[model samples]
Target: MSPASDPNARSLVQAGFSSDPPVSNPVALRAYRLARLRAELRARDYAGLLVTDPINIRYATGTSNMQVWALHNAVRYAFVPTEGPVVLFDFHGGLHLSAGIETVAEVRPALSWFYFIAGAQAPERAALWAREIADLLRAEGGGNRRLAVDKCEPLGVDALRREGVEIRDGQEVCERARAIKSPDEVIAMRRSVAVAEEGMAKMQAVLTPGMTENELWSHLHQVNIARGGEWIETRLLASGRRSNPWFQECSDKPIAAGELVSFDTDLIGPDGLCADISRSFLCGQVTATVEQKRLYGLAREQIEANIALLRPGLRFAELAERSWRLPETCRPNRYSVIAHGVGLCDEYPHCGYVEDNDRGGGYDGVFSAGMTICMESYIGEEGGDEGVKLEEQLLITETGVERLSRFPYEEVLMPSRWL
Candidate 1:
């Protein structure tokens, strides 16, 4: 039986979420996203954008096919002319994928010149690929040769340049366009968050002593795929000592009772939105350790303090200055960024810490309403036994911020839950 239909799965389901909710208004969502990308292109005076990144393609054309495979192999792409139609060059035999997407004006078989596909004739194949793109730009651009490209191989860039097509960074255009989400996009994100939380609950329910870290992490992937969600971006669940020096992917070590278990759900859920929530839970049925509570409490404090700073028009630097200061013991292993934007995946406008600025790890930007940000915190002293990670997905609004992720923290670990 499907997880949604299974009795045990039903019992673990969160109170407010639906396993398969009614489909959202795709028409409005697609229209809003396409318009946003076009506006960004127009603002930069680019003739068009060559969207090879699968995430950007989904944003522009609303066509998702083999997204995980396409991430490493650029087998499909889309082109959005600044003021014209969107043309999708899909993977082999994938024409039907975008048939119902109103924003996609045309679909064609993609030409891949990557080494694996073209072998010794890669150069020749790249030229052929460049020729088609140049012709499309000339026909739609009205003498404008400036084209923004999100990503491409050096051979492809050279080939396009040979065709007199000027290439600029299209990632900026895509990122800026994707920053301020439309109403329908927010609706889609809400669904993604709910699905992720449900998976989290399942993981917690089955979590027990002697369960390998991999076994616990697999529940998340199983729930996601079973519920029509996509992939988990990272294997970040760790128990006990492994949790201290963060960024360690899960392993085979058996979790012990009362030990701290930390996980980051870089989980891509429904509609390709990420429910990037993190939490540390006490393993097995035992009263939490004082040390565990201390670490978890600090992480929660950091997340809450940072999340409270989110508001429209707040500068990135000012946020770094005002963000909660990690104590000296925990400072060395702090999370790389205080927060980051989240949508189809972990996105742009990363909020960096003050220390990052000294080493050129920071940039200046301003928060805007309609942008969804993930507040992140990781607190573990350099030589500590276990670490705690806590994050919240939030939506920046006209007035302040709204917490998009509703997964509750560990009552044993948290001194007091934040309302």
Candidate 2:
């Protein structure tokens, strides 16, 4: 049965329960996000803005699904000026009834609202909708002004250009605003980590030799779904020789006795925040694989060491560089980076050893409070032999870093007492 259908699943579904707390509306948190977006637009010197990214849409409107697609192909957008309530272009009909939730328009009517066009895209209708949206901006005292557009897919941008609208890049401004976590966002993310830890704990009790990677992945999905998790971001289960850092995709190979199984579980919460973690286990009796043990040890050490150094005022690239240096036990591969920013998207402000001049590469950006990062380090042999990967989620605080997920990191599975 689906988790929502099960009565026993209610506790996990509502994991972040608090008693004797001020009853704040979820809409208040949403309003804060919209206010932040407006401030970003003003700082970037735009009269108004168009937010096309899905994540940005969720940020502006509390509705998280794909209802924005109904915006008459005119780019699902929120146009906010220096002052006044924001104008939202979205589909209101059917969405409210289907989702069983009030539309943003009903919640905040002070903002100008337009519903999705009902008919097919006749050129005339498209032009009319475009003109109407532009006229709304013009009525708000923004005439022929350059507007900041966030993540406008090529087709949307071309359509707007055809309609005589000027669009400028607003990626950096949006990224800077989204990089830091809010108090509510941090709490949601910690809850996601806790759910992942619970799922991993269950996995440790059942994992054994002769299980296929797919089978293990299925078990994880079942456990997570039972705990009210909607989806898993990734299920990377690589066993034995496939445990190398280069091996990312899950395989169907059966796990054998005395082989090391390395897996990374990245799961997402209902709020869209994520938690990424990696762990390794030995299937039967412990073998004298000194290199494997040492590699795991190094990965663990580097993760902890990097966490110790994480704080405000430190450059992001410096932390990455310090963690990428391989120990004498195992050789580092060319494909992987140590860790990266984890939030609305899996890899935001990509951090690691590799340098991408287009996007600031390695250690250049300063670490600030409220940044939630995943500190991961992995080492493997040259020929895709046995390897190890260790990762954990950390919150950078004013004084120090706090580890959110505290599951055991040893190679031996505690429940079975088998290494």
Candidate 3:
């Protein structure tokens, strides 16, 4: 049984979120993804795209065999011609053993890079892989002799070049295609968010003084994987002093009552999309101090202010120009970007700080409908201890933006004046 259908797979399921919209059909979702990618390749005038980045390969072909292993080693690859079926180069006959769920036309055994067993040379392996790719390009009617490649080792690139193939930047091709979410992509993200928030709820219920940061983080990982989600991207969970500078990740430090805990969930969920959300939690059932409330309020304000600025037709530069200005006391410790695009995993169009733009170099892209973005904020006083981090995922619609994240804020952390 699928994880969603298995009764024993999920240890707990909570049901308080009613505001989330219905998800689109998964079958249609996969189709939409392929169409978008093809459009991107055609627009860029590429003969074909060679995707070696595991995530890009998954995006193009919808297969996840040895994806984790591929992250560190270039074992598998996928080839998508401008107008033909996707050809996946599976390592160690994984394609033969796996089910063909996506739009794959062919699966060929990849040239193994593991040379230890037979004392195989690296040059020979590279040449063999390049010859196979060249054959595919010729068969696919590659006229321009230019093939876009996302990731490849130097030897492999050299081999391709020797085969009369000019390698172009294929990472941009995938990133541009994935920047805008189709209705079905949005639904997948919502499902991911639903599971992530449920994990958050579980953590909230059991949070108390003396709980180790590792113990608290386990709740999130357990629930995520239990609900068909894949591994998390980062270990960004910390408490008290560790939360101040940010990016501390989960540690063995014990939680203290009245101390603040912050976490960011970069979880790759059910459909390979990420549910990136951060929340600052107040440990135990103690009233937050005045300083703590002030910091949380400031971070919350920054998050909300940037999210409000999200809309179709807005340019990244303008958004950065109009981003929330940190007070002089907190400017030094402010996060670099107010927000960034999110799809498969922090995709593209990073909206950076106004200061960055003022220095004459920053990303610039017009906001379009169907783009999902994450608004981020980290407010910590320099030289002072403790900080509050907040982030929310949003879906850009034709008219406005929808908050995709459903995690609740720590009410006790709110400043009395704001309350």
What number of clashing residue pairs does each candidate have, in the order they appear? Answer: 0, 3, 0
- What is the lDDT, from 0 to 100, of the residue 181 in candidate 2? 77
Residue pairs in candidate 3 whose N, alpha carbon or C atoms collide under 3 angstroms: none
lDDT per model vs. reference: 0.88, 0.62, 0.82
Candidate 3 lDDT by residue in tens digits, 160-215: 99999988999999999989898888888888888788777777767889999999
Q: Which whole-number lDDT from 0 to 100 does residue 290 have in model 2?
A: 64
TM-score, predicted candidate 3 vs. hidden true structure: 0.92
lDDT of 1 by residue, 1-419 (tens): 34444555434344455555456788998889888988888888899999999999999988899999999898998889997778999999899988878999999999999998889999999999999999999999999999999999999999999999999899999999899988888888888887788788788877889999999898889888877789999999999999999999999999999888899999898889888999888888899878887888888888888888889999999899999999999999988999899999999888788998888667889999999999999999999999999999999999999988877777877765543
For model 3, the stretches where C-alpha displacement exceeds 4 angstroms are 1-15, 18-24, 114-120, 357-361
Query: Tens digit of lDDT per residue, candidate 2, span 133-182?
Result: 46655665356456667764454455566766777776655676677777
Q: Candidate 2 versus the native: TM-score?
A: 0.79
The best candidate by lDDT is 1
Sorted by lDDT, highest first, which candidate order results? 1, 3, 2
Off by over 4 Å in 2: 1-25, 66-82, 87-93, 97-103, 106-129, 285-288, 328-335, 354-363, 411-419
Q: What TM-score do all the candidates reach, one by one?
A: 0.96, 0.79, 0.92
